[model samples]
Target: MSQKIGILTSGGDSPGLNAAIRGVGKSARGAYGMEVIGFRDGFRGLVEDRTVTLGGGALSGILTLGGTILGTSRDKPHKMPVGGEVRDMTDAIVETYRRHQLDALVCLGGGGTQKNALQLHQKGLRVLTLPKTIDNDVAMTDTTFGFDTALGIATDAIDRLHSTAHSHHRIIVVEVMGHRAGWLTLGAGIAGGADVILIPEIPYSVQTVADAIQERVRSGKPFSIVAVAEGAVTRDEHTAMAAALQRRETASSKEERKKAKAWIQRLEEESTDHTLRLAHQLESLTDLEARVTILGHLQRGGTPSAADRLLSTRLGTACADLIEQGVGGVMVAARGEGVEAVPLEEVAGQKKLVPADHPWIDSARRVGTSFGD
Candidate 1:
């Protein structure tokens, strides 16, 4: 009997997910003569036995596709629902592996997917992981597949913002996606020629940001561009600002609590708020017209770039190789030119944040980009 391999895409969907799936399916079936089956909607499909045979026209022309054909979900196997009640589906997942007689399983997703894969492995399933996130926050991997595409999208948005900021002579803040890491914002900011870039790794003061804009204005450049990440926080001076909001939340009445929660949610999601709040503070302090433009969801939707397609293909192929080598509970990661399989334990819960002295960051600094510190 031919070896059977099950594959699934999980967590937030990205552009290169289909490419990775196609790579694994085509290589495993054509090269190794193995049977490839795709699990629909992540681990939920596996638990529910929702699978489809993958071969022939099913995997054709998917290298440049934007999302996974297998679908994806954020649901965890441990918390999967059974009938009408939530139940631990780990044993069910293992049972499905036995029912299908799968020799190995390929999981393609970001950090959260890797964590769940690790847990499944502990339950005795042979598994290999392919890193897939726009954030590129997964450790061990040099760069995840979808990051390049997201960077391109964010860069284009920033480039377009330049004309609007210049035309109106106002400060334009373009927010991009990056929770803890600044890879997307940093790369896009540099490519887009942002005057100031803010990231979670480096905290910034509102006054310093306002001063940077003022300095640009003083130099006859009346307009400025600020690129900020979603999770970017203000410097220590704004510690009291967040504290004041928290205090209001605590003291608010029941109806006021709902409003406070909504405001907090907006602050959490809005990269513009980070800059707008700073801009408003700057206006009060220096009187400048500051505006914010949020490039929400625009960064997440698009065709995968050539770089991302190639990277996803490489990672997918590496994952198949690892499984063939009987390597289980490992995430295939890109080091430099070569790919390495790192233990999932080392990758889960740990994030790869931007180092202060990274070469790219140094280059950004050399190019006169302020980090708003």
Candidate 2:
């Protein structure tokens, strides 16, 4: 009997996921003569034994697709919700692996999925992971599949904002994804020719940003584009603004209320002391109109770019090769020149951020891009 490989996508969905799935499934079944099975809605479907045969025409025409055919979820194996309580599903996952008679399992996702794949491998199931995330924060990989597509979307948004800002003489604040890293914001800002760029790795002050915009106005360029990561902080330094918002949404307890209030206070103080405050201050000081535009999910939803499609195809192929080689507890990552397998432990809970002294940063600075500090 041919070996059967089970495939699934976990964590947040991204463009090129379906392409990766098709790449792996087609190569596994057609080239290796292996059977491919897909688990829906991530590991949850695997634990529940909900699978669909993935081969033949089913895997066709998905190279340019934007989402996963296998679907995905943010559910973790150890903290999976069941009934009203969170339960560990590690054992259940192992049981399902045995029940399905899978020779190896191919997992596709970012950091969280890689961690789960590692845990599953520790439980004695053969596993291989393909890195996937718009953040491009997976360690060991120079870049991931969905990042290029997202960067393209974000850059286009910034470019459009430039025209509007020029016409209305407004300070457009375009927010992009990247909670832990600033790859999206930095890439888009530089490519879109934004006046100021803010990332999580670097904190900025409102006065600094305002000064840059004011200088632009003095140079007869009154309009300014500020590209900011969703997690980008002012000098006061609060992390994960999105997470903070989510926490505020779930704040019901007194302790939660206290923490939420503190978070809000910190955010307000930082904003009041920084760019938004500084923008209004600049208007009073320099008389330039400023406006904010948050490009939240617009960056995350889109068709995969050509680069992303090629990268996803390569990573997916590497995943199947790793599985065939009996490599478990590893993630297929693209290094400088070629692809290599990195231990999942090294990738999970770790993020690859833009280096402060990187040439890209130097280039951005040389071109007069202000980091707001």
**What's the lDDT for residue 363 in model 2?**
98
Q: Candidate 1, after superposition: displacement of residue 32 in Å? A: 0.3
Count of steric clashes across candidates, in order: 0, 2
Give all candidates' CA lDDT scores: 0.85, 0.84
lDDT: worst 10-residue window of model 2:
270-279
In candidate 2, which residue pairs clash?
A: 206-274, 206-275
Considering only N, C-alpha and C atoms within 3 Å, which residue pairs clash in candidate 1? none
Winner by lDDT: 1
- On residues 1-373, what C-alpha lDDT tens digit does candidate 1 reach at each position? 5678999999988989988998788888877788999999999999899998998799998887787899999989998767898888898899999999999999998888988999988888988899899999998889998999999999988988899989988888777887768989999999999999989888888778878888988999989898988778886634644764885668658777777667666655654456557667766755667777777777777789999988888887777777677788899898888899899889887788899999979999998999978
Query: Which consecutive 10 residues in model 1 have the weakest lDDT in total?
Result: 235-244
